[model samples]
Target: MAKSKFLAAASHDLRQPMQSLFFVFTALERHVGTDAGQALLERLGQGLGALKDLLDSLLDVSKLDAGAIVPELADVPIGPLIDETAACFAPAAAAKGLRLLRDAACDVAVRSDRTLLGRIIRNLMENAIRYTEAGEVRIRCRPAADGVRVEIADTGIGIPPEHLDRIWEEFHQIGNQERDRSQGLGLGLAIVQRLSRLLGHPVEVHSVPGTGSVFSILLPAASRPLGAETRRTGPAADRAGDASGLGRVALAIDDDAIVLMGLRSMLEDRGYEVLAASSGDEAIAALERSGLTPDIVVTDYRLRNGQVGTDCLLRIQEFLGRKVPGVVLTGETGQDIVSEIVALGFGAAHKPITGAEMRAAIERQMARHAGASASPVPEESRVAEPA
Candidate 1:
């Protein structure tokens, strides 16, 4: 428990700056128009991306060591995950004059934690892009005896046979003995190894010193596609198109002032009327005092005094006398919190979220709320009046 608490706090604190940088870059991207300015912005964005990757890798190690991460197994489609991964790494690969390919069997489902599995693949893709100077990075999915084997093959500088075993060690790097920061902190593969073991997925590597390398992970197969309920609320849903936020009110709560401010700025820039608060109680009080109902609620999962975003969502619904759609923004990776968020029927997005992601989630929630029938507030949700 103490370890979990420490890791949670550390993750939150470390992500604060990255979260702020995301918003700052977002705001900057809107104002810059010159080619030179755009180039500078792009470079800064890349730097931010590297920093975020490092921070996430560190957190993953901490969480894994503390036994805080648990897999939320589900039947997830391979096509969508493959497509998303390709889209994400295409820019980086193109920047290096390399081709990114994805050849995965559609309609194939894998029983695994989507987020963790995605992270593993992403790490491989990022590493592939970093080392490859001119060739291509290919992602292929095929059937295995037990399940499916997804391979990330890179035509970059190949690994020496002797160094293959040491590659999984923390902070171990090959070919760049100078400890070049641009090459990454050498934690990506380490995290991937840990995550693969945690999910009971077997990872394999093949490489020749002068040739390239292929990293593969074998995941259990699922009998059928993910259910409608899972599809509707999964994190991947946040990758949809940007919807307009005109006339919609969003109540956002976060303990960090910088994060709260960044979120408000990002939402207001998209035409949302945002109500910002520091905690669940504050949000409820704001709604009560103003006698205003919100279209959706956006909050950080870990708030002050061990208060969670779900509590705020429930309280906000109680205040509004109807069920209100909500989005939970979090930096924590523990499966327990993720399960709770999904069970509570809220859209979840991890922290250091891009502006587009945040907008998509809010818009999706708003659209759902508009289409669904409003349910009456439950008796248990009613607050007791002061005597």
Candidate 2:
């Protein structure tokens, strides 16, 4: 209840400045055409980006509570994840005169959840971009025996050591006095810390008052052989070749005809042979008689007749004999709902969906399922006993 009020108040307060800033920057970009105006517009853009990050962090927190946050762990190339995240903030970093640099050795693939990791780094980078008035933001990575340590070091206003411990706490803030009056302060780091804990990764910070700050994340090592797996391990597959079987019999069960149609279209466009079931009973009947075995299940979180998406996925996976991948795509974003989704350990994507994002989510599910078994599954093998 308190969180609700805080969110409402925060939204109303923050959006006001963000909207005004957007318009002012847009107008300035259109008219001034001068270098000075360009710089000012860039500054406004950074401010706006910071504001957006704060709000996004809030939404993520709410989603986590609602059980909508799901982690689909897969073999992801460490380099691309960092590169993509860094690219997203490059403009903001440049506008602040920060030289953003990244270092990588070989393509190290790790068994980890990509979206959450991306968000974690993004939170730190966004903060680095926001607080640092000068100097560079450098990302350094080195492989550990079992995991890897990735660091985001920024030459900005160094965090006080006492503040470092508190920074990861929910709703904790340090230097955003101005931004706080308008919108928020502590949400981003809190979100980061929460996600890191969920993924079982350790986050560390080192800062000297006048020098700079370095935030490091230690993640489990990627499982990749130095052979064909290396070439294939670079996050290019739907599921590791071993797990591609899951999407072969993909199922979309939703009561909403529009949702069913949309999911069908999405699957068809992505070249997945999709089967639709309108209700839990129908889905059960179809699976009981027919030889249709689902490799992956994608369903709406809410369905008619009080049958939830979680129940449906659980039932079908139980039937499949082999463990299969599942994703729940929904429109609801309350924290409890999101938390339930996350606790189930499926990929959760919010609705009002974009085609690309939907496809990407499916691909991640597939790859994750594949990478779960480093030892290849022979093409003709169903080695496991039937459930």
Highest-TM-score candidate: 1
Clashes of each: 0, 25
Q: What's the lDDT of the predicted structure labeled candidate 2?
A: 0.68
Model 1: lDDT equals 0.81
Per-candidate TM vs. native?
A: 0.80, 0.52
User: Could you list the CA RMSD of all candidates, in the order they appear?
Assistant: 4.2, 11.1
Q: Give the TM-score of candidate 1.
A: 0.80
Per-residue lDDT tens digits of candidate 2, residues 204-238?
A: 88998878898889888766543444444334444
On residues 1-387, what C-alpha lDDT tens digit does candidate 1 reach at each position?
676467567776777678878877887776899999999999998888887777777777878877878787988877678888888999999999998988845557888998999999999899888888988999998889988889999988999989899999889999888988888899888889999899999888999875799999998988675555444325644444447668877788988887788788887887888889999778978887777778878898887787878887887777677888889988876767877887777888777777777888777766655667889778875545323
Specify the poorest-scoring 10-residue window by lDDT in model 2.
Answer: 377-386
lDDT of 1 at 113: 90
